[model samples]
Target: MLTSFYKMHGLGNDFVILDERMGALPLTPDRIAALAHRRRGIGCDQLVTLHAPTVQGADVLVRFFNPDGSEAGACGNASRCVADLVWRCSGNATPVLQTRAGVLPTSRTPDGLITVDMGAPRTHWQDVPLAMAMDTLHLPLPGDPAAASMGNPHATFFVSDFGMVAQGHALEHDPIFPERANIGFARMDGPHHMRLKVHERGAGMTEACGSGACAAVVNAVRRGLAARTCAVELDGGTLRIVWSEQTDHVLMTGSATTAFEGTVDLAAYPS
Candidate 1:
């Protein structure tokens, strides 16, 4: 079947979005991976699928799939992109999205940026699901990285420079993180700003990673290296991340842009 899709991006972390709200589409993991292959298919950092909401107060169900075809618990940038799409279609500035992680509330800021309340950050080793218990604030890793969960596991390495970012691939598969982890290399520019580069699990290095920014900020705060609210500069662009002290929720604000819209025959791709 030919499926209609939207080519969208939050910063430069692009996605191929398929709306399955009206009906279920024949989308297997391999098919999704095929669709995300840069040389062989539509090519995107990730594939997002929208389905009918199954929970109360949610406008839609958002699912994120990595290029490797693994399902991710949450994706901050993708959420903003999906929220923007839903808001434009329903004419609602605020839209709630349900995902594997939980319900997330999103809204459009006065400046035309989309903000997603990414809920509270998780710090427990159990939450990160480490192979064993350890202090999340100062992991035993070489760079003394820290770990946090924004639905999915993340390990942030605060560096004086970006030279150590090359270790991301090895750290991601370390036995300590049983479920694997997104590795973020953060360089503090100041208490209120930082530069970031992430080797996302399954998706490799991307131009931007919203959840990584959130996790990096949360981890930085825990280490007393950054303030609760900070600006994160990624390769694609910058994102304003506010770790609200009152709610303990992380708010990610950024632009979601549509590159184009197109249709593809699922049958033509590997299933």
Candidate 2:
């Protein structure tokens, strides 16, 4: 079967989006992994699928899959990209999307950037869902990393340099995390600025990571290393994150772009 897909990106973190709102597609783990293979199939950091909303008031249902064929609860960059797609399709500037994490409200900025209200950060150890109970502020780890959940597990290690990309892979599979985690290495440039590199859970180091950026800012604020509202600089671009004091919701602002769109034969890839 031929499947139509839209190729989109948010800050260089690209995705191959399949809209399944009208019809269902055969998407197994093996198929997803095969489709994500750079050389053999359509290459992407992740695959996004749009489905009919299950919840009332939600404009659509969004699902994210990693290159390893693992389903992710939340993805910040993909959220922005989906919001843009929905807006262009339905002409709804403010669209409500339902994900495994929860309902996400998205809006367009005056400057044309997409802003997603990522809800509040989950700070408790059980919320981050560590292997065992421990202080989330300071985990019993070598680098003294902090843990927070932006709908997904994340561990942020504050370092003086941003060259610890290799450490992210090791820490992502660490035993402390019950489920694998998106490991982020952050360096505070100032009270309102930070530099970050994230080794994602299923996908290795990417050009950008939206949820990782939010988790990094939340962790930095908990450590008093950064202000509540700070600019997080990822490899691809910068994202403005504001852990709102009034609403307690994290607002992530960035740009989403359409690279191209095309159709592919599903039978050509193995399931």
Candidate 3:
């Protein structure tokens, strides 16, 4: 069997979008890892699949499998790419996206950017699902960490500096998080902007991470460090996240580009 997919990028975080409807293609951990291999595979931070909706209200379901075959509940930049795929497939200008988090409304903005309603921030101790309960805002990580959740669990920490902690022996094999989270070290340059360097679990260091940016903004706003609406500058580019005034919905606006489209051998990831 052959699996047809579209290679797309939201900023520099790229993905391989598999349209299973193109055929019956199943994925496994080994296959996912191989597909994400920079040299031997399609090379992406994550792989997305468009599947039939599991819920009644959703127009389509968006699912993302990280390079390590772990599922992520929310990914802002990927959401934009998924929206464009759904909109193009359905020929609808406005598409309703549903994920484990909840309903996400998406559309193209005036500036030709994809905008996603990322829903509310989940910052409670239990919601973040830390090993034990603590004041998530002031929780002591083995390092400077802001334990929070955009959808799936994430722990964002601001390092005293980026050089000392650029993903070497400092983070890997650590026991702070049971499922080991995607680590982002940030430096706040101003009240409204910050720069991020990441050591994503499974996907090591990458150019950008949409969900990581969302988590960073949510945590910053909760701590009163940054405004509700601010820009997160990642290694790849910048993302705009707004913890909305009236709805508390985190709206992420960014660009999505189609890299190329082709078919991959399903023999690689057979069910």
Could you give candidate 3's per-residue lDDT for residues 8-119 as a string of tens digits? Answer: 9888888999876444466887888788778888889988887777777778788888887788777777889988887777787578888877878898888888888888
Candidate 2: tens digits of C-alpha lDDT, residues 213-270? 9999999999999999999999999999999999999999999999999999988887
lDDT per residue as tens, model 1, 1-271: 8889999998899999999999998899999999999999999999999999999999999999999899999999999999999987889889999999889999999989999999999999999879998999989989999999999999999888889877878899999999999999999999999999999999889999999999999999999999998999999999999999899999999999999999999999877
| Clash-forming residue pairs, model 3 | none
Better of 1 and 3 by TM-score: 1
Ranking by lDDT: 1, 2, 3
The C-alpha local distance difference test score for the whole of candidate 2 amounts to 0.94
Instruction: Name every residue pair that clashes in candidate 2.
Output: none
Error of 3 at 170 (Å): 5.1
**Over the full model, what C-alpha lDDT does candidate 3 score relative to the true structure?**
0.78
Residue range with the least summed lDDT across 10 consecutive positions in model 1: 160-169
Instruction: Identify the leading candidate in terms of lDDT.
Output: 1
